[model samples]
Target: MKFFSRLSIQSKLMLMLLAVSIASILVISYVGYTSGKEAILENIYYQITELRNSRARQVQSYFNYVQNHAITLAEDPTVIEATVSFTDSFNQLENEEVSSNMISELWRFYEKEFIPRLQMNVDGNPTVLSYFPKENIARYLQYHYLVKNPYDVDNKSRLDMAQDGSKYSEIHQNFHKFFRSITTRFDYRNLFLVDSETGNIVYSVHKDTGFATSFKDGPYAYSGAANLFETLQNNRERGAFEVIDFTSFRPSYGQPVAFIGSPIFQQSNLVGILLLQLPVNEINRIMTGNFQWKKDGLGKTGETILVGSDYLMRSQSRFLVENPDTYFKELKKQNISDRIIQRIKENNSPILLQEVKTNSIEKALKGEEGLGILDDYRGVSSLVAYAPLKLSDNLDWVILSKIYVSEAFEPIQIFGKRVLVTSAILVPIVTILSLFLSRRLVMPIYRLISGTKKITSGQSNVVVTVPSDDEFCQLAGAFNKMARTIDEEKEALEEQIRKNDALLLKTLPAPIVKRLKQGEEKIADKFPHVTVLSANIVGFDEQCDLMSAEEAVGLLNDIISAFDDAAQRHDVEKISTVGTSYLAASGLFVPRLDRDKAVIELGLEMLRIVRAFSQEKHLKFEIRIGIYSGEVIGGLLGKQKFIYNLIGNTAKVARFLMIVNSVEGKPNSILISQNLYEPLQEFYQFFKMGEIDIPSQGKMAVWLLSDGSHKK
Candidate 1:
């Protein structure tokens, strides 16, 4: 204490200020680092969770599409007639006899062609007679479609006529093209017509050994086809569809296969079953995102998988497909069955073969949707997002979007390193700032107070001076005048600044305005993660034609004001309004984890606003809103009359969607692209509206917002 007293005033002040500034900076940096860590974790959780929800929606949407189409085909008039005619003809051939030469050729075909392909896929030997169609009618039909057909096994569906001079041939010829088209167009493995009465598969589009076999008493009676037939018999509800989980379908050479079956009803009477062989390729494509995992924002070591309630994988793992050595090494550590692991290796896939047992999988299997840092199936610590697919109770498929914990938190680790380096660099800088501020700021106030004391004692020509350039210098310059009217003048200046700020804010975002005031000429910023919403008001011009100019302007003002309020409420920044179009964006001034969600909410609210305005004010106007998310450049355009504007393909796509939806969609349509839907499916209800091809942006899938609910 005595040594400090010996120092000069500026040195004493510097020491004290340096100590205070150091302590404050240390405390603030610690708090900021801890809070920033948590904030980053939350963002990572949200990112993976959004990906998981997107994959779940994709799976559910695809199944729903196939289900609706299956039911439609079942109810088609042509299909109904084909079922009646084919069953009658199939039954009539129960006593039909085949010559000895034809029987020999059938056996030869199965032994030489079928079994070779079959054994190439399956481990054990499967007998031909076990899968052979039973009864004379089945044998006769198989001989024509399978053995005697001119096309190979894959191309057998091309044979429309057997040329055996039978009614079955004529029936097959009439309807074979239509059924074959379904398989080709939709990428189905096969299509089957099963007689509802006898449980016999009377016809098949791609005739395999299972063709013309009876689901009731055939050798392969316990197959997915039989399971589907029994399910339809148990449930007679309209539009009921029975889906069989993936199994080793022997008819397809023990390859994994799933089934989708709907009952064919001819005027309220069950005639036949319409069965579609759900191609695993299509399901895999949806689950794996066509093997473009990185494009979906899943970083290195990140993958999305589907697991059934049985704890077996329903989709292939990214590591297994891309890096088999590491995948198998991890599996070995878990003590999994060698045979099962070997089988997966032989098949080069994990679907229905590899077991995925973990806490995340268990939670998802229980129909829970959430995210956490947990050990995954491979026993690696992972950041995971889990959810149950809402396709059906029977499927009970769970989806997981995950990345290795090390990779997910890699950014945080980098931030921590940067903090350490920054702390080291900031100590010296803080010392300088503290010493400069103490000398420049403190002595001026002290001298000013001392001079005021002299003035109070009736002294004349006493001036307290500060040489530094700042607000304090202005105070020193007008010291005499400031003492009398400081409060009034300060208030007046603040009011003027407030008016200017409001005018600037009305035209530009707060962040942009701040940059302009800070001497940043040609103000510009690149926002990589923002969502843009473009909305168009329809019938407004026609309504304005009937009204006077003042009334039309007033109506537009009311709508724009309401929109501005909605944008504020939803945390969206209004960019511009041109004629009947209003444009907005999110994650510009302030970053948000829910940028897509906020913009979607704003778009929906704007639609509601327009609807209410039309009804409340008796106007016949309509609104269509569209949203797209991507990178954007925001900057001033014009020299004098410029406002902060967003320019990018994102805005272009949004405008196109708005215009397209206005023409073809409902009066108030809110359409979001696949990019936006992927992140918000868990929170919003969306209806897939097919694809729209833009001029420069190619084809994009669009979903219509349903029920105006975009929040959980």
Candidate 2:
């Protein structure tokens, strides 16, 4: 107390101000630090998640494009025509250009359509099976069920010798040669055939060149042919995977390469296995390129890598080595201990840690995606993203991407440090000015209090007069103005809400209406509904049954247009059409106003349209519709995909009723569920029919609309 008394009043004020300034700076710094840390972490996590999603989409896109191209190649009338012609004239060998043209066409398909879009390097464009009708591999598998046991060694040897020697045999060498051409045309080095029934290794691409060695004496070879069968059985039961060791030869390095094994399935039944071998280096290169990282300053800081479900390093783009031994040692030197190694092995995806590897990789292996970042774990800092690989049979291994903290978050840290330094220099000057103009601050504070009082009284247009060069005074004036503007805008916003409510009521049902108003959730809920209607042309089937296929399709399309018009007029929603059956429904998101009435009205309108259609187009049978109503559920089921549907008991009943009601009643008839009939008894005309049996449903009472004769 005595020490304080010795100081002058001005000195005391300065000391107090200095103390307050220091405390303010500390508080600001702490808050800024915490906020920056959280922001940086969130940014890293968001980026990793985005990258994983992008890669998944890219993979799916590639697959879809490949499949579409395959379908196009299969369906080209030219290919089909060429194949048919070749099959018919094959025994006679009448046209060489026809076969040459077919090959040329396939070559074009490969160069123009497939190679540009996908990573697949085909040996050649796929060949049409029609060109080799007797040796049609797809069809052969289609017809034959795999026999668990096919043959003994003696029988297999005799079959192999016969197959190797015969030229015009169903398993023709020329066909194999042509297939090899197809694979090579696509730049694929490997092409092989699997005996669909027996799982035996048939002719490979190398065998097509007439350079072959029998799998007889090598350690990789089966002890006897019996052992080969056993291996096939094991493969069939366990599913396909990369074979680490197999019977095959390679260049100078005898080290085993990766072999992708694919099980052949015909009509949903496993037939055999096809094995394609590529050097492990090849797969590593492709995988690396697919998930390659990009960094602003450093070359892709987060290394794109892969680990097998077994937790072994499968491939790494940034960390490459011919052998695992040296790399394992290197990891340990970086403080990744044996325990860390074991933990990493446990995870299949990218992981981060200072003490231990996280389970993000394990989740990915188990078919769930996960990502995270950790510091000082195992004494190393890292940020990681992990995703499961797309595998056919086994749990897909996890792909892990990681970058050291100093590398991954370097930019953010640098920026944050700059902000802190700038703030440290600027805040003290601002604080000193604030202390000197205490009197000026009092004037604005009083004016602000007055403005706030007006604002509270709902006079939002009130403005405060502030006179000062200080930024705080300017900020108070701006805030006062902003408040006034905000109050005026609120009125306009309320009006907009009223209009939106009206629109929503018009577009959605009662439940959706209430939920959306409360802002509970935006996605539509799935609910069960009970009716489905499918309409089709009645006599057009018979009329076009004998007509040319193209002409028949044209005639059927004309009839379906009339059905669409009727559906539109009656406010029914069309789901899809199969052949002549036009499927639709009346009650989906919008429940039926009068379920029975809606069904009857739709049936009558369809009859009217089909009658008009017959008069205009000279069609015989008009239209037959199938309507059944039963309990089924429908809603948007995915985050990224949206579909609105009708489902329930009523929907099923509507479908079943279409056939039964139409068959026994008139040219067009509406069928109603028993529940629907009970409600509309007083308003609609109907004739009660006893219980009837449906295909899937046991029995239910049905009614026929009386065509407005016996109302109620």
Identify the leading candidate in terms of lDDT: 1
RMSD (Cα, Å) of candidate 2?
A: 55.7
- How much is the lDDT of residue 244 in candidate 2? 30
Q: How well is each residue in 560-618 modelled by candidate 1, as lDDT tens digits? A: 98998989998899998888889899987788898888887787778788888899879
- Strongest candidate by TM-score: 1
Residues 156-188, candidate 2: write the lDDT tens digits. 111222221222234433344554554455433
Candidate 1: Cα lDDT at 397: 82
Residue 335 displacement (Å), model 1: 3.2
Please report, as a residue range, the 10-residue window in candidate 1 with the lowest summed lDDT: 481-490
> What TM-score would candidate 1 get against the native?
0.55
**lDDT values of the candidates?**
0.83, 0.50
Alpha-carbon shift of residue 82 in model 1 (angstroms): 1.1
By summed lDDT, which 10 consecutive residues of candidate 2 come out lowest? 140-149
